[model samples]
Every structure is written in C-alpha cells, then in structure tokens.
Target: MSLVLDNVSYRYPGSTHGLHEVSLDVRAGELVAVIGPSGSGKSTLLKLVSGLTTGHTGRIVFGGQDMSAMPVHQRRMGMVFQNYALFPHLSVLDNVAYGLKLRKVPVAERHRRAQELLGIVGLSGYAQRGIGQLSGGQQQRVALARALAIDPQALLLDEPLSALDASVRGHLRDEIRAIQQRFGATTLLVTHDQEEALVMADRVAMLKDGRLLQIATPRELYEQPASRAVAEFVGLSTILPCTVCAPGRVDLGFAELHAHTGSRPVGTVLHAMVRPEHVRADPAPGSVNRLQGRTGAQRYLGALTRYDFEVPGAGKPFLAESARPAAEAIAIAPEHIRLLDL
Candidate 1:
C-alpha cells in the first residue's frame, strides 16, 4: 500500500522542544530510503507511521484510507528492526511462523508458509537451526523472512544491515532489495548510510534537525541539491566560502572559479562546493582552470584513489579523487564546481 504523511509534527512532552514537521509520500510498490544524521528524526518518523508513538499532529493516509486512528497491529505493515528482534530460544521455523500463529493461521498452513519463506530467503534447509546458531547475516535473513511471511501491505526496515560485517552487509542488502521487488512490497528503509540509500532506494528523503531537507532520486540529491546542508549531507564535498564574481563565476581567495549552481546577486557570499570526483588532478599544460598545488595525503581505496590537493592561499586542501592518481597540477572543469545558496 502507498503511504502519505502531511505536515506531521511530533515532539516529546513537558518542555518546548525543537519539533519536527514532516511530509512525504511513498507510492505503492516503491522503495524509499530515509537518511539523516543521529537524532535527526529518522526513527521518530518510522515510529509515528508504525503506531509506536502517539499524539502526532498531522494526517497519515495509507492506500487512500485514513489511517490516523489505526492501531499498530491493524496497520498490517511488516517491520524488520536493526537488532534482529528474534526469539533466540526459538528455532528459525518457529520465529518465521510466529506472526502467522498470532493471526491463528492453521498450524499446518503457517508452517508450510514459513518453510516457503525460508526458501525464498535462501535458508530452506536451515529452518530447524536456533537463532543463536546462525551468523549475524543469517539472523537478519530470518528477520526478513518473518516480515515477508505476513504478506504485509507495506514493509518498514530500520537499519536492518547495521549489525553485519561489511561484505555480508553488502550482499544482504541486495538480497533484501530483490525480495522486496519479487513480492512487490512498498518499502521504507531508514538508514544513516548514504551509499546504501543511493544504491538501494528509488528515491531518498534527507532530514536534518527535525526538518525535511529534500526528497529526490539519488542523482538529483547529489548533483542538484536544494540547499548547502543537502549537498553536505548527501555526499563528500569541499565546501569553501566564496563570493559571486559574475553569472558563471565565483572568487575564492586564490583564484576565480567557473561554476553552475544557484542564482544570486553579484558580491553575495555563498558556498562553492566541489565533489571529490570533480577535483581533477594532473591538468594538461596551460589548461584553462589549471592551478598548481602540493599534495598532502593520498590513499589507494580499492577501485578508487583520493588525494588532498592544497591550493596556495586557499587555506585547507580540496579533496581530489579519481580512478587512478594524477600528476601534481590540478584543474577543475568550470561545470564541475557548484555554488550553493546557503
């Protein structure tokens, strides 16, 4: 089912706290990732939708029905938690079938369904194993199986892969996305990992300090952010202070830069942001934007490389990265730089 929240506001009682005013729409069968820093109301948004919290000040509509008063159990939304909230004492089979048991699906039918779900999650033969016997990734699969066995209208996941090791986490996230697609479940994944959102979600909603920053496809959020905060949050960027010199240029302390982003009056102070990938190293002789700088720190990170290129009089270095390391002189394409309206 699709989900919608309009002007939803929530706050803890007693003192006047900095409240959150949230609004977004999740289409049926679409996967959306909610990302933010710690305490930016990501979990609170999920809690309000799942009926774990009360006294919300706005409307929640699900599948075109007013779900403002619906109770948690009645919502029929499947939730997979970060900690794999499974019964350690119970066998995998029982845990997967427990939700069905609560709904009083006949014993034989529920077990049959649970077994099917286990197979769907690639754990067919491990049904009899206890939760403690499985690895973190295996336990997470079991949690997913349980959530799926319900055949829920919508699925909610709260950092489901946070506990797993790096390689396993990467593999399992793909598995979860595949399963969600196969079942056509409308999913909401809450995560602090930006790459996870970019790789897995069809659209991402960015939040900060109890406010919604922007909601867009991963590319839009990265390439055309609405505010300086959005650019800083969505990816790695070198945000430097600059003044607009003309329609397509901004002046840093050391040199004038050409860019495309934001429309503000001349002489207005703004932030000039350049992504690590846009910071080009080893320019051709006499390149238009060529600037000489000393290299500070460089690292070979598997498929990619990163270097700190320190421009004279620009204070700190701008982060430069590429598939392979380049020569000392760096050049930035005019279109690669972005002026952010703060």
Candidate 2:
C-alpha cells in the first residue's frame, strides 16, 4: 500500500514545536528516507503516519484512506524502533510471535508465521535463544522480524540500526533493504545519518527546523542542491566567492572559470560550489584553466588521498582528492572548474 502526507502540519502547545506543512508521498515497494538533524521533525512525521500524535491540519493518507482518523493499530503500519524494544524475558520465537498471538491467530499458525519472519531476517536458528543472548545486530533483526510478522502494509523504521556497531549497521542496512524489496512493502526510514539516506533510499526528504527543504533522489540532492544550505548539507563542496567577468565566465582569485550561470551583476559576490573530486592537482602544460598553488596539507586516506591547497588570495582554501596512490603534484586548471550560485 502507498503512504502519503498531504500538507501535514503538527504543532506543540507552546507554539515552538512540530512539523510545518510537510508534504510527501511513498509508493508501494519504494524506500524513502526522511533525513535531517535532530529536532527537524523526522520523528514527528513518523508519529503522524502511525497515528501516535494527532490534532493537526492536513491529512495522512494510506491505501487511499484518510489515516488521521484511524486507530494506531488499525493503520496496519508496522514500526521498527532504534532500541529494538523486544521483550527481554521472551525467547526470540515468542518475541516475533507476540503480535500474531495478540491478534488471536491460532497458536500453531502464529509460531509458523513467526518462524517464517525470523528466517527472512536470517535468524532461523535463533528462535530458541533468549533475547538477552543476542548481539545488538541480532536483536535489531528480531525487531525487524517482529514488525514484519504482522504482514503490515507499510514499514516505518526509526533509526533502526543506530544502536549497532558500524560493521553491523552496514550489514543490517542491506538486510533491511533486501527484506523490504522481497516483501514489496512501502517503507519510510527516519535517520540523521547522511550516508544511510544516500545509500539506502530511493529518494530523500531533507528537513530543517521542522520544514521540508527538498525531496529528491540521492543524486539530485547531492549534485543539484536547490539552496546554499541544501548544497552544504548534502555533500562535500568548496564554496568560493566569485564575480561575473562575463556570460559563461567567472573570475576566481586563481583562475577564470567557464560555466552555466544566471544573470548577476558583474560586481555581485556569488558563491560557487565545486566538488573535491572535480578538482585536479597542478595541470598539464596545455590546460586552459591551469593554476599553481602550494600544497598546504596532504593526507593518505586508504582509497583516496586528499590535498589542501592555499589559493593565493581566496579567503577559503581549495581541496582536491585523487584515487589510489594520490598524485604527488596538483593539476587544477580553469576549464575543470564550475560556478555554482545560491
């Protein structure tokens, strides 16, 4: 089933809290990650969908029905939390089966369905183990299994892997995606981790101060950010001050760049963003944009070596990166530069 928020807004009693006119849609079988810093309304958005909080304007729609009026349990949306929230006293099997039992499914049928879910989460033999015996990752898998056992129309995950170690987090992220894909469940992931949003979601909604900044695919958000804040938040960038020399050309302290840009007065101070990878070390002899500068600090970072260079008069330094064995020399030139305006 599809899930959608149509111009949804929530407010706290004091007037200084909640989501503001946020609108988004989640299609069946698609994974959409709501990403932002803390207090940006990610959790509030989830509560609205699950009917945990109410008394706001706009509608929460699910499967073509208005969900705002539906009881939380009637929404048929399963939720997985950051802390696992499993019953420590229950065996893994029972923890996964608890929901089915509560719904009054036959005892045999509940156990059968719960075991199936455990298998989907790669916890086949773990059914008999006590919850306390499981590792953080295993515990999260159990939580996922429990959520899935209900055969929910949609899955809402709140920082689902935050409690696990880095390695476990990576593994579980893939696992969650796989399970969701297999079941074709409409899924919404709430997280503050940029990497998690970039790698896991079909699309992302970036929020700030309880407002939706932008919603787009990971590529769109990272490469064509709509604002200075969006660009700075989505990826690594070097925003340098530049003045328009003419159409398609702008002058930086070190080089003249040719790029697509809008009409700005010649003396206007505009910010230009360039990705580190787009930058090269000292250029080849015939490069049009070649600029020379002293390398300030260079460090080897396994897959890539990063260099910090001091541009003669630019207030901020330039950063460039090279793959594998980093270039001993810098090769930046004017032609490789792009002028980004915000």
Candidate 3:
C-alpha cells in the first residue's frame, strides 16, 4: 500500500518545535526510512501515520483513503517496536498469533498461521519456546513474525534490530530486508542509525528540528545533500566557504578553483563540500586545488584510513580518506567538489 503525507504539521502545546509542514510519500512495496537525531520528529511522524497521535493539521492518505479519521486498530499497520514488545509468558506461536486471536480466529487456524509465519521468518521449530527462553535477536524475529501475521497493508518498524549486539544486528538487518522484499510489503522504518537507513531503505527521509529536510534515494542523499545539515547528517564532508567567481567556479582565499555553482551568480557566498574520498593526498606537483595544510589526526577505519588536514580557506581541519595515512598537504579536485547554499 502507498502512504502519503501532505503538509502535515503537529505541535505539542508547550513544545517549540514539532513537525513543520512535513510531506513524504512511500510507494507500494517500497521501504522508506525516517532518520534523524533525537527530537527531530522521526518517531512522531510515524505516530501520526499510525494514528497514535491526532489533532494535527494536513492530511495523511494511505491505501487511497484519508488516514486522519482512522484509529490505530483500523489502520492495518503492523508495528514492530525496538524492544520487541512481546508477552513474556506467551509462547512464540501464541505471540505471533495474538492478533488473530484478538479478532476471534479459530484456535487451530491461528496456530497454523503463526507456525507458517515463524517458518517465513526462519524460526520453524521454535513455536513452543517462551519469549524469555529466546535470545534478543530471536525475540526480534518473533516480533516481526507477529506483525506480519495479520497480512497488514503497511509495516511500521521502529529500530527493529537495535536491541541486539552489533553482529546480530547486522545479520538481522539483512534478514529483515530480505523478508520485507519477499513479502512485497510496504514498510516505513524509523531509526537513528545512518547505516541502517542508507542500506535498507528504497528512499530515505531526513528530518531536522521537526522538519522534513530532504527525501531521496540513498546515493542522492549521500552524494548531493540539500543543505549543510543534511550533508553533515549523512556523512563527513569537508565544507569550506567560497566566493562564487562565476557560473562554474568559486574563489577560495588563497586560490580559485572549479566548483558547482548551480547557476548562482558572482559575489554569492557559498560553501564548498568535498567528500573525504575526493580529497587527494600528495597529488602530482602543481595540480589544481593543491594547498599546504598540516595533517594532525589519524583514524584507521576498516576499509579506509582517514587523516585530518588543515586547509587554507576552511577554518576547521578537513578529512581525507585513503588506503593508508597521507601527508599533511592535500588537494581536492574541482570536479569532485559541490557548492551548497549554506
């Protein structure tokens, strides 16, 4: 089912920032992730869609009907929370079938449906195990199976695998994505972890101060952010102030280099953003955009090593990623640089 939010705005009576005219759309069978820092309205947005919070301006349409008038129970949304939210005393089968039981499904049929879902989630033989007897990751699986038991039109996940260890979380992230795709279910996931959002979602919606900043594919969000905050949220990018010299170039204090102006005319103040991977270390002598900066920090990431270097126009040190540590002075190519409105 497709979900749409049009000009939705919400605010608690005493709060300063609540959602501010946020709009987003999730196509059928697509997984969209809502990611932001704390109090950015990621969870609140989900709550509004799920009918947990009401009395908001604007319309929420899902499955071709207005959702503002619907209650949570009638929304047909299966929700999996961060803590799993299972009944401690219930067996795995019973937990998965709880929704069916509420609707007065026959005892035998509910068990059959629950067992089938457990198999789909790769827990075929654990039907009799109690929630307390399972590991955290296993509990999460049960939560997912339970949510899908009703064959919901939309699935809402709130950090579904966050309670598990790093390795378990990594594995379950793939599992959840696989299961979601296999079922062709429309899903909305809310998470603070950037990797989860970037890896799992078809499109990522970034929020800031209760406002929707940008919604785009992962590559677009990472490669070309709409604003400085969006750039910082996605990943590390070296931002340096520049004066627009012309349509395709900007002037740094010590040197002028090619940059993307987006047709902003001369004398406009802009910020040049170059990703760490684009920052070339010890380029050929006399290469364009070369600057003498002191390298002070060394960070050994698993796939890439990062070194911080002080650039001329940038007040703060900028990072460069390489196979190994780099020299102090570095040069970033103009083609790899993107100019932002700042």
Candidate 4:
C-alpha cells in the first residue's frame, strides 16, 4: 500500500511552531525515510500520519483511500516507537499478541500468530521470557513483532533503533530492513540519522524547520542535491562562494575552476559544492583544478583519513579524505563540483 501526505500543515495551539505546507508520497512497498535535525517536525509528521495527533489542514491518503478523517485504530497503520513500548509485565508472546487480542482473535490463534511473528523477528525461543529480561535489541524485536501482529497496510517507524547500542543498532538496522522487504511493507521511517536513512530507505525526505526541503533517492540526494541546504544537510560538503566566469566555469577568487554552471550568465554569483571524498589529496603532477594548500590537521578514521587543506586566502580549509595521509596539494574534478544558487 502507498501513503501520501498532501500539503499537510499544522500548528500548536498557542505556539507558532509546527509543520508547514508539506507534501510527500511513499510508494507502494517502498520505504521512505524522513530525516532532519531536532525540532524539524520528523516526529510530528509521523504522529499525524498514525492519527495520534489531529487538526492538520491537508489530506492523508493510504492505498488510494482518503484517511484524513479516519480514527487512529481504523487507519490500519502499525507504529514502532523509539522507546520500544512493550508491556514490561507481559511476556514476549503476550506482548506480541496484544494487538491481536485487542481485535478479539481467539487465544490459540493469536498465540500461533504471535509465535510465528516472534520467529520471524528471531525471538522464537525468547517468546516466553519477560520483557525486562531481554536485551535492548531483543526488546526492540518484540516491539517490531507486536507492530507486525496487526498486519498494517503501512508500517510507521519513529526512530525505532535509536535506543540500541551502536553494534546492536547496526545489526538490528539490517534486520529491520530485511523484515520490511520480506513483508513488502509500505513503510515511512522517521529518523535523525543520515546514514540510517541513506542505507535503509528507497528515498529520503529531508525536513528543516518544519518544511520539507527535498525528497529523492539516496544517490540523487547525495550526488545531485537540489540546493545548498540539501547538500549541507545530507552529507559532508565544502561550499565555496563564487561567480560564474563562463558557461561552465566559476571563479573562486583564488582560482577559476570548471563546473556545471548550466545557462547561468557571466558574473552570476553562486556556490560551488563538493564532497570531502571527491577532493583528491595528491593529484598527478599535470592534473587540472590543482590548488596549493598546506596540510593542516589529519584524522585517521579507520578505512580513510580526513585532511584539512588550508589554502592561503580561501577563508576556510578544504576538507579532503583519502586512504593515506594527505600531501601539500589537492585537486577537485570539475564534474565533482556541484553548482548551487547562493
């Protein structure tokens, strides 16, 4: 099933903060991740879709059905919260079966379904254990089982793995994506982690200050960001202000570089954006776009080393990444430089 939010707007009763006119569509059987900084309305968007909050001024549709006026229980959307809201007093099986029991399923039938879901989440043997006895990862699995028990048309996950440790979170992240794909569930995942969104979602929706900035596939979002805000938020980037010197060229004060300045007139001010990984620390002697910058600081990050290349009058150092230590100069390819409006 697909989920769509059409120009949804909301405001707090006495405050001026809330989601602005936002529109998004999660395709059928596709996982769309909503990511942004704190107070960016990530959680509010999830709450509105799940029908936990109301009084929005737009349509919320599911599977071609207008669900704007539908009650929470009738929305047929399953939600997994960050806190893993499992009943501590209930055993794993009972916790997973709670939703089924609420719908009046027979004891034997609900238990059978619960057991099946537990097995799917890799908690079959722990079904009889108390929630408090399980680790954070295990508890989250039970919470997932409980949400899946309802067999929702759309699965809503609000930072579901945020509470787990790094190691456990990494494992559970893969597990959740596998399970989601296995069920072919239409999912809307709310997260503040960029890596999580990029790795698990088919497309990413970036929100800022209650507004939807951009929605695109991870590759598109990373490599071809729509604007400077989108470029800076999605990943590490060095944005340099410049003026269009020609049809496909920009002057960065210190040096003029070739870029994809599409149809912009000469002397038009713009920003040249490039990712750290795209900056070559040591280019061949006769390479293009070469800049002389003394290496300042270097940080070893396991597989790659991050270097700060400080050019004489560039205002700020250019960040570059390579597998080894950086030399005195760096080069940036014209194709790797993305031009954006200032």
Candidate 5:
C-alpha cells in the first residue's frame, strides 16, 4: 500500500526537537530509507507513521485511507526493532507465532504459518530453540519472521540490522531486502547508517534538525545533491566556496576552474561540491582542472586509500580516494563539480 505524509508537524511539549512540516511519499512495494544523524527525527517520523505517537498536524494516508488518527493495532504495520526484541522466555517458533496468537488464530494454523515463515527466513531448524540459544543473527531472523507473520500492509524497520556485527549486518541487510521484495511489502526503513540507506533504499530521504532536507535516488543523492548539507551528509565531499564567473566556470578565489553552472547568473555565490571518488589523484599531465597540492594525511581503507590533498590557498584539504597513495597534485573533472546554494 502507498503511504503518504502531508505537511506533518509535531512538537514536544517543552522541547524544540521534533519533526516539522515534513512530508514524504512511499510508493507501494517500494522501500524508502530515512537517514539522518541522531536527533534528526528519523525515529519520530517512523513512530508517527506506526501510530506510536499522536497529536500531530497534517495527514497520513495509507492505501488511500486516512491513517493519521488510526490506532497502532489498526494500522496493520509490521515493525522490526533494532534490538530484535525477541522474547527470551519463548521458543523461536512461539516468538514468530506470537502475533498470530494475539489475533486468535487457531493454534494449528498459526503454527503452520509460523513454521513456513521460519523456513522463509532460513530459520526452520531453530524453531524450537530458545531465543537465548540462537546467535544474534539468528535472533534477528526470528524477529523478522515475527514481523512478517502478520502479513502486514506495510513493513517498518527501525535500524533492524544495526545491532549485528558487520559481517552479519551485511548478510542480513541483503536478506531483508530480498524478503521485502519477495513479499512486495511497502517498507520505510529508519537508519542512521548512510551506506545502509544508499544500498537498500529505492530512494533515500535525508532529514536535518527535524526537517526534510532532500529525497532522491542513491545516485542522484550522491552525485547531484540539492544543497551543501545534503552533499556533506551523504558522502565524503570537498565543498569550496566559489562565485560563478561565467557559463560553465567558477572562481574559487585561489584558482579558476571550469565547471557546469547551468543557468545560474554570473557572480552568483555557490559552493562547488565534489565527491572524494571524483577527485583524481596523480592525474595525467596537462589534465583539465589540475591543481598542485601536498598530501597531508593518508588513510588506508580496505579497497582504496584516502588522501587529504592540502591545496595551497584553499582553506581545507580536498579529500581524494585512489587505489594507491596520492602524489603532489590532484585533478577534479569539470563535469563532476556539482554546484549548490550557500
């Protein structure tokens, strides 16, 4: 079912930190990931949609039905929490079947469905195991199965994979996406991890200071961010203050560079943003947009090395990532320079 939030605003009684006039549309069978730093309203937005919190302004519609005032149970939303929230006292099978049991499904039928869901989550053999007996990954699988047991209209995941180890998190992230697709469930995933949002979401919504900043596909969000904040938050970027000097060109005080400025009037102040990957280290001789800079700091990431290239006269170092350490200079492609408002 399609979920829509229209001009939603909520304020805490005595605190200023809450969502404000935020609106989003999550298409049916589409996965939209909400990403932001702590206290950015990602969780608050999820809670509003899940009917966990109330007294908000504007409308929330799900499948063409007004759900803003609906109770939690009536929302028919399945939630998988960060902690897994599995019942320690109950067996895995019972945990999965608990939701169905609350709805008064026949014991035999719920068991059949629970067993089938366990098989779907690759936990068929662990059904009778106590929650304490299962690994964290396995426990998470059980939590997912429990959420799916109810055949929900929409699935809400609150940092579902954050508690697991890196390897387990990656594996389960893929698994969750696969299962979400298999069931064709409309999903809203709240995450503080930008990589998780970029990897799993069809579109990512960025929030800051309890407000919606931008929402776009991963590629668009990364390559063509709407503002300086979005660009900085989504990935490693070097944002230099510049003034539009001419069509397809900008002046960065220290140097003049060719860049795409679209139709921005000349002399308009903007920030030139470029990702680390787009910055070329040790470029070919006579390359366009080449600059002389000393390498300051080097970080050896597993697959690539990140170099902090300290350009003369530029206030901050331009981050560049390459397979090997950088030399004394770097180049940024003109086309890769994204212009954003100050």
Candidate 6:
C-alpha cells in the first residue's frame, strides 16, 4: 500500500496558491513527517490526504485509488488532532471503542479489540476511567487506541503532540514511534515543530510557501540540504558571504579556504553555510578559513554553550557555538582556519 501525490496543488478559488506542484510517495509501514512554518501549508496537505477537502488539481492516489474520488469515510484513514478529541462523558474504553461501534462491530468484539489496543499504548489499566480523570498523556493514549481500533489504512496526525507539556510530549513521542512500528501502518504527521519532525519521521518533507523544499532522511536533510532556504530552515547555520577565487577555494577576509561550490562561473557571489557546531574557536595556524573575533558572551543551554563572537575582519560579527561551557572560547591560530568562503 502506498500514498502518493502526483503534481498535486490546491488554492482557494480566488486565492493565489496553496501547494505548488508537490509530489511525494510514502510506502507502507513508513512514517513521513511534513514540517514547515505555521502558514507553509502543512495542515492543508493533511486535509487533502484525509479527504477533508477536494476539487484541487493533480491526483492524490492511495492504495492505487484516486483519493479525491473517494468519500472521506471510505478512505480508511485515521486522524488524530492536537486535542485528544475524546468525549468527556465517555469512559476511556468507550472512547476507544467509538469508531468500532460506528462500524457495527459486535459489542464483545469491540471491547476485545479496544482492550488490546489500549494495552499496546500502555493504557490497559485505565480503560474504564472517565476521560476527565486521565492526564493529558493518558488521554492521548486513548485517542491512539481509538484510531487503531478500525485498523486504518493510513494514520494521519495533525500536530499530534502540540498540546502536551514538554515532559509529556517526550514520553508520547516515543510511544507514537513504538505504536507505529507495532501496527506497521503508513503514517503522515503534520507539524510545525522541527524537533518533532526530525525525531519522528523516517523521512521529512520540508515546506515553504506551500512548496516542498526537500524530502530526505534526517541525516541527509541536515548534511546536504538542497538550497540556502533549506540549509537555514532545517538547522542552525552561519551564512558567510564569499567571492569564488578558484576551484574549491574561496577567500574570507581572514584567510583563504577550500570548499565545493559546484561549477559556478568565476566572480559569482555566493554564501557558505556551516553548522554552529562546525564553527570552531581558537583554531591552529594555517587553518582553512580563520578569522579573529571578540568573546562577546556565552550562554549555557543545559548541555551546550552558545558563543557570541564579533568577527572584526567582517564588518558584522558572526555567531558561533560550542558544546563546552568555557569562560572563554578556544584560541585559534592560522592552522585552525576551516574555510574562507562567504
């Protein structure tokens, strides 16, 4: 089974654009995350997949059938929202069994299936408790159980853990991954949270202005982003302006460094991006691209320290960070220079 979008795009009748020529394929039993800014159309893509909206251009194919032609209910998709969406008056067991009941499963069989799912989600003992009595984490487990009761063809999550407290969200994130693995259901998660996407997805599809920027594994997305927009959006990057001086080498005011800018004509102005952790302080002499900066301040972020430095050679100071929380930054000589591209 597969969920595929072939040049699918949508726009409000009079609006400019929603999604632009987006295409992707999620194989069975894989978890795909769609992440972007608030208005980047992640939610809108979810709606189209779940059959909540139609009449758009291009084709949305699910299990070899066009989804736009199918009714929402017949699509066999399970949706979980940020809110648990459980009925307050209903017991956890009853809430988990709601979808099964609607499908006319036998009462005994429904309870049997619901109990099994609850166990898988680690909420076995709280099945009969009222929704009001369960904590937010427990409520979310109940919601997961309910979604699984029908053995949905595809699981769709819309900002699934956004409502929970930080600690609870962490616990649920692991649980969600476990549940997805256990069920082997194709899943699509819609979220604006970059950490969630990076941690949860088998592959992440980054969006911007309703367009798919890049889709790749977490490692690929972080290490080899396709464009500047992607490089900045996916992680912390220090953008440096540079003039291409020669093949594989560029000059920053401090020194010249080696780089790979891929066949750009000479004299082209370009920017070089390096992850914060890649920027080192106090390098040795003959370093690739060494520049001196002032030790502005250090901020301890639990496990790492963010270093603020003033690059004197460059008119505007640049930022660098490190995992160690030293009172002062490492001393860099000419050898510690990494690259001179900007």
Q: Find the candidate with the highest lDDT and give its number.
A: 5
lDDT of 4 by residue, 1-342 (tens): 889999999998998778999999999999999998899999999999999999999899899998889999998888999998889899999999999999999999999999999999998899889999999999999989999998988899999998889999888999999999999999999998899999999999999989999999999999999889898888898999999998888999988888888888999998899899999877888788888878889898999988888988999989888897557788899999999886
User: Given candidate 1, what's the lDDT at residue 196?
Assistant: 90
lDDT of 1 by residue, 94-184 (tens): 9999999999999999999999999999999998999989999999999999998888999999999988888998899999999999999
lDDT of each: 0.88, 0.83, 0.89, 0.92, 0.93, 0.81
lDDT of 5 by residue, 1-342 (tens): 899999999988999989999999999999999998889999999999999999889999999999987899999999999898888999999999999999999999999999999999999898899999999899889999999999999999999988889999888899999999999999999998899989999999999999999999999999889988898889888999999999988999998899989899999999999889988888888889999979999899999989899999999999888897667778898998989988
> Where is model 5 more than 4 Å wrong at Cα?
none
Q: Is candidate 3 or candidate 5 better by lDDT?
A: 5
Residue 39, model 4: Cα distance from true site in angstroms:
0.9
RMSD of each: 1.5, 2.3, 1.4, 0.9, 1.0, 2.9
- Superposed model 3: Cα runs more than 4 Å off: none
Report the Cα lDDT for residue 278, model 6.
Answer: 66
TM-score of each: 0.96, 0.92, 0.96, 0.98, 0.98, 0.92
Name model 4 segments beyond 4 Å from true: none
Task: Please estimate how well model 4 matches the true structure, expressed as its whole-model Cα lDDT.
Answer: 0.92
In model 4, the worst 10-residue window by lDDT is 320-329
Model 2 spans with C-alpha error above 4 angstroms: 253-255, 262-269, 324-341
* lDDT digits (tens) for residues 154-253 of candidate 6: 9999998988899999889988998998889999999877888899899999999999989999888887777778877887766667767887666665
Estimate, for each residue in 172-197, the C-alpha lDDT of model 2 and write its tens digit: 89888988899999999999888988
Candidate 3: TM-score?
Answer: 0.96
The residue pairs in collision within model 1 are none
Deviation from native of the Cα of residue 245 in model 2, angstroms: 2.9
Where is the poorest 10-residue window by lDDT in model 2?
324-333
Weakest ten-residue segment in model 3 by summed lDDT: 324-333
TM for candidate 5 is 0.98
| Ordering by TM-score | 4, 5, 3, 1, 2, 6
Q: Model 3 residue 315 lDDT?
A: 67
